[model samples]
Structures are given as C-alpha cells and as structure tokens.
Target chain A: MIRARRYQDARAQARSNPELAWWVFMRVSGVVLIFLVLGHIYMTFLLTSELQASYSVVVNQLAQPVWKIYDWLMLTLAMLHGVNGARYSIDDYVQKVSRRVWTKTLVYGLAALIYVLGTMGLFIISKAMLAG
Target chain B: MYRAREGQWAFALHRISGLLILLYLLIHVVSISLVLFGANAFTVLHDIYGFWLFRVGLIAVTGGVLYHGFNGLRVAIMDFTGWGTAVQRQLWYGVLAISLIGLLITAWVVVPRILAGH
Candidate 1:
C-alpha cells in the first residue's frame, strides 16, 4: 500500500541522517511543551491579577532554583523544537541548493543568538535574585 | 503555493504559527533581559504586558500555541508510526477539534478576566 511505501521512505530518510531523530524530537518536545506552556500561562496570568504579577513576584519565583531550571528547560526545548520545524519549511520551499544552505545558515545563526541571549537573561536574573 | 486543501492549510498554519512563536520568543528574551538593567526597568516592561490590549494579544498567542502544539503532535505521529498515516486526515480533524475547544475554553476563562482589567 501507499502507506507502507511512505513508511519505508521515512525509515530510509531517517537512516541517512539525524533528521529522523529530530523529527521524532519535535513531537515529543511538542507534547511536553504543551503542558509546560499551559501550566506557565495558568501560573503567570490566571492565578493572579496583573497587579500581583509584578517584577518582584517574578524575581521571587526565579530566586528559587527549581523555577530557574523549569524555565530554562522550557526555553531550550521551545527554541530547538521551533527552529527545527522552521528548518523543515526552509528545506521544502527553497528551490536552489545553494540558497537553502545560505538560508539555513542565517536562520541557525539567529536561533543561536536568541538562545544565548535568553539563557543569559534567565540565569542572570536568577543570580541577581540570589545575591540581592 | 495557493493550495486550499485541508492538509495544505494545516501545513501553512503550522509554519506561520511556528514563525510567530519564534518572533515572540525573541521579543520575550529581550524584554526579560531588561531585568538586568534594574527592577524598575523590568517592572515597566512587565506593566506594559499587563495592559489590557497586550492581554488580548496574549489570547491570540495562546491560540497559536495550542494549535501548533496539537498539530505538531499529529504531524509527528504520521511521520513516526504506521497507523498514523493511514488516518492522518482524521487525525488532522481531531487536532482541529481539540484545539478549537481548548481555545474557546481559554478565551472563555481569559476574556472575562481581561475585561475585569485586573
């Protein structure tokens, strides 16, 4: 059947590179992100009014090591999962091989920059909370 | 390009939502980074987000995340498992149904709170 052939193609494609691994990762991470993000929204927005979700409240939360780790994990998974998904779109739409490479390079570069900045912002706030 | 089929539209939504989330992430990182400057700076940014208009925007974000996360799961299942592809179209509908219900519930809960302006 066509399904079997498509499955075989997927297996072969996965064998050739790490694309398959990432393909699987997207799903797994996506499920986890759903919970994490929903929980985050509930805690940040639903649990309290805007007045209560002040800078001090956030600082107080991040001061705890657990929150710091939870947020970092959320950030890491979200970035990797999202960037990989975008890469798939880029590869599919970009016609020329050379253009694809350049586009991916640019995309990856921006992703990395955002990741680093996010990490720094997260950790620095944690440190500041701890010290002060 | 310009395909109006369900699958194609789903694909397009996934791409668009993913990119929008990425853009939001960049802004979120930069805004949070303002905390490093001082608590006053961070508080200002936080207050801006607390504005009712921004809260409404967040409803759209919640919808985007719900759709993307659920649809991504469907896409993943189709790619990984044998049975998934067999019922892929059904699964897409299932995803839409679940996401719609979820978004509606979220809007139901959030809109009133936003209107209260608290």
Candidate 2:
C-alpha cells in the first residue's frame, strides 16, 4: 500500500522521533504569549504603577483568597510555561543527545523544584495573611 | 523502545509547562479581580499576603515570574533572531545559564530581605 510504504520510510529515515508536535506548538503558543504577556505587562507595569501601587495596595488587592489561589497557580503555570517554551525552542536548535538530555533534565528538575517552593511559600503566606 | 534524549525531554516539558501557565494565568486574573471589585476583598488579601508563609510563597512565585518572563524573551529571540541562526545552538544554553545566575542573585537579595522582615 502507498500508506504502508510511506510509514516504512518514516520509521527507517525519520531519525529518532517525529518533532512535528513541538514545532507546531511553539508557533501556536508564540502567538498567544504575545497577547498574554503584552497585556500582562501593560496592565501590571503600566497601569498599576500610575494608580498608587504599593505594598499596602498589593495587600489590599490580595484580600481575597481567590486572588491568593490565583497568584499561586499563576506562579506555577508561568514557570512551567516559560521553561517548556524555552526547551521547545532549544531542542530545535540543539541536537547533541548527551548535552540535550543533561540540559533539559536540569531545566525540568529546577522548574519542578521552583514550583514546589513557590506553592509552599504562597500557601504559608496566604495562611498567615488570612489568619493574621 | 527508543530512548528519548535530553533535547526531547526539554521539548516535552516546554509544552507541558506552557499548558500549566495558561491555567495559572487564569487563576491569577480571577483572584486579582476580587481586589479590583471591592474593599472587602482587598482587606482579606492584604492580611493573608503578609503572613510569614505567604511571604515565602511570594519569593518563590517571584522567582518563577522572573524566570518565565525572562526565559520567554530568550525563546522568542532564539526563534526569531539573526543572531540565533549564527550562534543558534549556543543561544538556548546561554539563556538558561544567564537565567539561573540571574535568579540566584535576585533570590539571594530578596529571600534574605524577606527572612529578615520575618
């Protein structure tokens, strides 16, 4: 069958793995982050600053437990997103098996560590703020 | 089974992390909206955020924010830039190294300050 022949070709000649997935994602997400990040910057950096932003102001804003949960989650997501995004781009550029493994291992491991710490920190702070 | 290498791992992780960020951003927006909407909500956030546990969380979250935000810029550049082509391979590692170093430095100062405050 033509399909079978094409499949064989992919298996025999496609190096180690099909990278079409990551390639596709970087594109789709690159477009999204442009808006998410830009709006984020504009809102927090630009607008927040002019409107009497301060520690107290932040505290005032964070008054809701929902916001605390929101921040904790955002912290986790942002770390994972950025790290992964970088990895996607990096993999396309770097092909050395040894280096890539160690590098990605390090990136992911560190990111995981950061997420744990951040979650705990946020939880502790929120509890304190709520209870205090 | 063919073992996937480091590059592959990084690639997989990147996509997973991206999805995570989308969720996190959603939560953040909803939470902040509480404060924007009224004084009562703002008071609750202010009190909870000041707690020792919350302060620690703030530091960790800040680290994530810096890393994600900065590293994103790195990715965008590597994908789009001429320099990325010339130094292409080295760029990602270079960005990763700088990010780690930058995070460490920022944490050193910020973490200690938070600790001192507590």
lDDT of 2 by residue, B1-118 (tens): 9998544444454444454554455444444445333447645665565566755554444344444444455555545455543553465466457557755765565565556653
Which structure among the candidates has the greatest DockQ? 1
**C-alpha lDDT of all candidate models, in order:** 0.77, 0.51
| TM-score for the A-chain in each candidate structure | 0.78, 0.55
- The parts of candidate 1 lying over 4 Å away from their true place are A1-8, A94-105, A126-132, B1-3
Sorted into a CAPRI-style docking class, model 1 comes out as medium
Q: Please report, as a residue range, the 10-residue window in candidate 1 chain B with the lowest summed lDDT.
A: B29-38
Which digits, one per residue and each the tens of the lDDT, describe model 1 over residues B1-118?
7648778888889889998987787787777767767788888888888788888877788788888888878876776677887887898898889878877877888889888876
Q: How much native contact recovery, as a fraction, does model 1 achieve?
A: 0.64
**Model 2, residue A54: C-alpha shift (Å):** 6.7
Model no. 1, DockQ: 0.56
Worst 10 residues of 1 chain A by lDDT: A1-10
